[model samples]
Target: MIITAVLPALSKEASIGNIVLSEIAEYKDDKQISHPYNEVKGAVLNLHQFNGHNIGVIIPAYNEENLIGETINGIPEYVKRIYVIDDCSTDSTPEIVKRLTDPRIVSVRHEKNQGVGAAIISGYKLALEDNIDIAVVMAGDNQMDPKQLPKLLEPIVEGRADFTKGNRIIRGYWKGMSKWRLSGNFLLTWLNKIASGYWNISDPQNGYVAISVSSLRKFNLDSLYGGFAFENDMMIKSNILGIRMMNVPIPARYGKEKSKIRYNRFIIHTSWFLLISFLYRISNKYLFRFHPIGIFYFTGFILIIFGIVLLLFWPVLILGLVSFTFGIALEMKEINKSQLRGL
Candidate 1:
């Protein structure tokens, strides 16, 4: 496969080297399997010097001066290019990138500081322009494991899915993540399931991801949310576009990397974002795509709204709550039925 890894790096000076080198080791382990494929009793299914595939790494940096150089140096020699996007950093991020002498490194700068979503978009556009077949995303903080790239790419390369993402909450892995972050991610995942209709996906906030070029082009890049909600926003878009998606069980990795997110602000903004996006999806799917079942979501929403508004009137409140609950149950049943039929 023509593979490209996109790293949305920030101020990762302390940990970037270890993460990058880990990717090299992962690539070496992959190269040892001569056939690279096997037949299972029930089923089936990157970057070092052993393989013939062209590889690229895109690192979008913002004020990542201390770690950007180490990050770039750690890419395996087999990688064909590394695209570094500087998003108007007030620090020396650009100069650090410019000082790198590796022929594989290519730098792009944003005139202003956009969010991580925008930085990834910039990297994605470059990967597309470079004609890469598969584009993978890795956060600059080094929280994502480099060894798991193979797992993320298997479904896409095998034509089983168009998009694949990491699921940090799977198989009891949440025990390692911070309690506050874990709770927030779970809540966001629940909300995302309702809005995006991807009941199967978890860890909605995990940024480790991969997408086929064909599937990536199907989205309107300009319209994607440019904040922390960007990953969730992409899930909603995937639902709207009918992209086949799956999640890989990956463990959470947290260290000295300081988070730039403010939970209070994030909660308010992301709530509004999802609410508006959900409404837009309802309108688009029902009115435009012609999915008749959209009425279920609307009915449930309206009843819930009425129930909250009539809280002072005990009789109306009780009646409204019952009806709202029933509406949600019916909707959920329908969704389950659709899944059973393989819709």
Candidate 2:
């Protein structure tokens, strides 16, 4: 198979040079089948030119003492710098990160525990100040395989996407991930699809990702949430900016590394955060940031409001919920949740 050949080359180095679309046939995503691959091939060709580019990888750690070394060790030599942000760990995670002697690796310790989002933002800011062409995120727990790092960068390097991430929801890859994590990621990813205009994107929760500097400045990182919501929320922000975001399917490797995420917390947190992020992105992009076909949205909104006021004041008016439903249905159609979820 085409991927069988390309996988070996890609795994060895971040650059899979001279790869043709035909060669990547085995990795051809069915979701993308309708889009054709000439675009992807062109992007791949462009990706080859980014060798020797300045790159920074952000490894955010909490209590990941058992796995931090593997993450630091597997980083490709070509990366310009590695930053480990220790979010006030109760364990030896910060000490372990400080022990890494790679000249390119820098360790930053927060005085108190900040959320994953804060750590990532801090890392990205440092990377940006360093003037790196690309900024990558690979968690300290070592769930991300270094082999797929190049693939995540390919789309960004090729100008196909300003941001790209690892998508573990290949259905086949679900086996390697815990059922709880997998299910939660699926829900959040689906919600993200509805919130952001980017559709058919898989695995929004996979933190293994790369972003172009252009994409970084477009977001006000300080305003985003500080935990798991960060990833999904960032995608929504990117979509609002008309920045292209895509995913490369990657196999997940979850081991004994303790998951900082708890299901009950995630459920309560993700629900509230998703609603807030969706509304913020929708308001900014459709209402305040940029204007598209929002004349209809406002008209529909006003109609629903008027209908509600009329219905409240007069029992003769029965069209309140109907009008409100019309606006909501149109909004949902515009966002296209089902399409984005790859249904």
Candidate 3:
């Protein structure tokens, strides 16, 4: 005689261990099952290996005392190093991390509060110094799921991409996100596509990301934007360097954590920075590189300005619009050639 056991449905916030437990429990209830729970869990958790590559996780934290410990604890055992950059947290964040006896943990505290971008940069610098093969960025708020980290690392590990980022917009994974923030993200996604020349990528603002340290060595880290626009700027610079990027579908998790971003100010400031960066990309990638695409963009803008300033220039306005459209199409074609899709 066989007895069947009932298991509760796992929620979106369920961890890998919990999910594995549920699966193992269900299998164990069947008479035909043979694998033990610990064996199954170990198999699921240690699914990925980077050969000899060293993987380092960078956790940029700011007063994340409540959830920081959980975030650090959730990291997989395969990770070689965990760089926690405390941005001068006023709380006991530093103390809590210190209490953890994990030898892999490297605590770096700023004398004053640097922005999140600055903290990540510090981690990147250290990773580069230590010859880390891959560096991943996860928020200290525990919002990024460790279960999905392998998704971000796979593309880079397989030599398919130089950079990989978590895409929360796919598969309705973003349903857990706040509606207002989702709306704002939708607007920025299109804007970022144009500015960064990465028309195929989505969820440009998602901070859960992984980068090949070799790619990091290609650009000047100090030149990157030091605030919320940092991720957007990374996309722009990566496109300029012709770096291949892949988007991994990862679900968004919202718990008791509150966002520190002020979207009203963020939108205004980031939009302006994107515009300037767009002009720079056009100039650097096209004009400086002797590509004719820049002429189309410049002439289009000049004609549009003249068309608006002078009356009876409607024909010039139409020509300007067409020229700009051609430029954008050509740019997208060039960029798409190097873009990689999710697994």
Candidate 4:
């Protein structure tokens, strides 16, 4: 039952405090509280001591000198160790981490600047080397609330799931989230649901997550996407491995941390990434593999395209339309049948 938390930060000195021991809204009634820490601490204390569960925390920092200490200090005492990965920050992020008095803190520095995903992958490698049982991902900018972590960890600990993530869309909590982000989240989530074959999860963009070490080892870390699309890339890989993923309801917290994302670029870049990943997923899941549904899905897509191109030929257009409709019907039927089978 050993658990480790991983935090990825990038130039977030202003916003990291918003996440540490942050106020969490009660799922039942939306009542804000500051003591998810107490509840989680108590739960850990009550676990069977003989089970030997140890919790380790990891932080990936890149030029986050202003708020790294606050982020590290805010972690609950129940954790066994904190790994801070300094991804070649131009600032004094590594120096700041070294000055921390907590003996559990371990700093790993990268010689060059890699993206956040690479930093996280590096930390994952370290966690695996040390044989950490379960690794949790938290952000260095403090967007992830530690109080709700138990919800994410419970399924993995109980052997019900290999990976778990936070879902901020439940209960219509999107009111506080930025409208642009809300739209992007919805689009990406829908695409991810189809691509990953994990229909139960929403808010696929949510970074707060916990994954079993065994599952992490199954991935080729070097091949994963390195930018903001990294999380979405992980989901696709997880689906390929047939690992179970569960989503826990968690509220979104926005604060002083200025987002590095540019809306136009994010949408354009991520949309392309998702579209390509979706095609790759379909190919791997159906065409490359022996799955009946994949045949119908792709046939339907191809027919639709052909139908548009052959509009001048009335007979061919009619035939393509009919074929496309039938293909879509079969694909839908198989999707429903698969869901029932899972149940």
Candidate 5:
């Protein structure tokens, strides 16, 4: 005989802010309940003080049934709206979100599974329609700390930056990350710095971010990259548009959530995307603007190639390297001047 059941049955536990915790176990041969809810920290901010800003949080979820409820419940009361973009989750993710009684929750289900980036774009569009003054992004897996959201908002709230993002590398905050993941993040950070031209920003991969809706209006949202490279692409676009970006030091959180990314494929694809984006940024910001830096970059590339082909012309290679370095230094100086310092 074969049998299937949700071991221990579906149970709901009431928590602070009337958040419901639905503990449902998957049916298996072992009939074991393995899903564990990581205890999310309470909000540290006085919600009333932030009521003036129409803040909206965009949560992009796919197959995140285990912690979706907790993630939603963890959002601070200061946020005026919660846009949960359900990217066609096969599990009970959609149902779980629907069950939440929070009036602030606006569940938007996709007809088919799109990438997380597409999901976030959908939420951004909705936030715009609602005229949200600020938009923040947090993963649906509960990996982001809700309590630290205030930190990300501080710079923007103070009119210091148009874009603010979490940086896990500062002050040993990235200790929670595994060695392999940390190494991969470091590699991507270097590539993204070159691609985005935000030399001052680190940890470009951290998705915990906040941006003013005004900045979002400047972007052609439909043209943005709709994949895991979304964050990196956003940074590149911001730098091109001269957006003021600030980095807030936030700690990394790892719990029962499993990473959906396949790093091998992700690195290859994102690296290529960054390279192309680098060229696009250079063309738009320097060449289109008739900036002399473009000449240095183009000349350096041609000279370096010819110098290598003509092995006797070693002096040409040195000159090309100097030209390229000078162009990069000048670009960095310009970007640094526009970037706002984090509080």
Candidate 6:
């Protein structure tokens, strides 16, 4: 509402485009390609006005020497610094970072190719040392637009949310995304939300995010998995701690950079990760950490026992089949569907 007038200069295309008959509430249709340019402007303004906090950008690159420069140059001047960590890439990424002329840019090199998760953790540590109040993760592949950066960070900056993430599947980018990937993200996202207990979230696999200094300080960084399942694992742990997670929408840009992940394998690996992370979060939050329920393992043990009993002989036995049906129905109500079968 107010953002449209305040951000006239920010995006003539988005503003004028929204006024077009086709562009109004383009987000409502699942096939409209547009970014909420005015929304991004409002978010950037909110970030500046909230608490006077400083900002930092963390870009984790594997072999993205081609597009990283433009991605870096596109960030607004208000952002304090950019940390470009070369995750032991085989390409010329390291050399490109060294040649960059921006004074605010800092580069880190890893001896071996650590996965994206490890690189992000290292960047978080670096930002903590630099005294940055908030840290935002950007991909080495320039798929995410920097104009939407502020929206991802505003919640944490305003002290209204502990952690914030981008939800491309729900955002204006939905139209730009493929049906298969969209389906995969939805299934995994729905599973993660129930398993982790953050019911209000969407787009569980998106990597773009902003985290507060306090949340980062309180997190057990050593416990997070450093590979592809890192973001899901982080949210699982955060949910256990009762940290608020808010998902902001961003424009999806799909281009020449090949997705390192295979879709089928993504589902299997992330499903296992969600189960493991769920148990860990429950154990750590309830048993080892605190007994909010006044019993160390009441809820966890009950759920596990019920699951085991139903799985024991449900296939062949009639009584066991009945128990299994009732048990699954109860759990379906509690956790909802296992995975969203369709996008």
State which candidate has the highest lDDT: 5
For residue 169, give model 1's deviation from the true position in Å. Answer: 1.5
Per-residue lDDT of candidate 3, residues 84-195 (tens digit):
8888899999778767655456667777787899889988987887647899999999999999988988888888898998999989999998888999899999899878
Which regions of candidate 6 fall more than 4 Å away from where they truly are?
A: 1-51, 287-343
Q: Write the per-residue lDDT of candidate 5 for residues 188-258, one digit (tens) a residue.
A: 99999878888889999999999999988999888888889999989999988878998899999999999
lDDT of 4 by residue, 1-343 (tens): 1222212221111122222321121122222211212222211121221135455556767788777777788776655556787777888776677666554454667667777788788767766765367777777766777777778777777777788888888886666698888988888788777666566778887888888888888999889987778888999888777777777888888775557667788777887787788678768867787566566556655765676787646665566566545654654565455444433
* Model 2 agreement with the true structure over 1-343: per-residue lDDT tens digits: 1110111001122223332222211232222111112223211111122465667889888888888888888987777667788787898876665555454555666777778998898788777766478899999988888877889887777666768788778858778987788778778777666566466577777788899987798778787778777887788887777666677888888886778788888867877777667567657767673454343444444555576677654432334444434545665564464334432
**Candidate 6 lDDT by residue in tens digits, 65-117:** 78777777777777766778778888887666655555445566677776889
TM-score of each: 0.75, 0.72, 0.82, 0.76, 0.83, 0.72
After TM-score superposition, the amount by which residue 340's alpha carbon in candidate 1 deviates from its true location, in angstroms, is: 9.7
TM-score of 5: 0.83
Better of 1 and 6 by TM-score: 1
lDDT of each: 0.65, 0.66, 0.78, 0.66, 0.79, 0.66
Cα deviation in Å at residue 94, candidate 5? 0.3
Best by TM-score: 5
* Model 1 residue 304 lDDT score: 64
> Which residue ranges in model 2 land beyond 4 Å of their true spot?
1-50, 289-343
Indicate the residue-level lDDT of 328 in model 2: 51
What's the CA error at residue 208 for candidate 4, in Å? 0.6
Clashing pairs in 5: none
Pairwise TM-score winner, candidates 1 and 3: 3
Candidate 1: regions farther than 4 A off: 1-56, 76-79, 287-290, 312-343
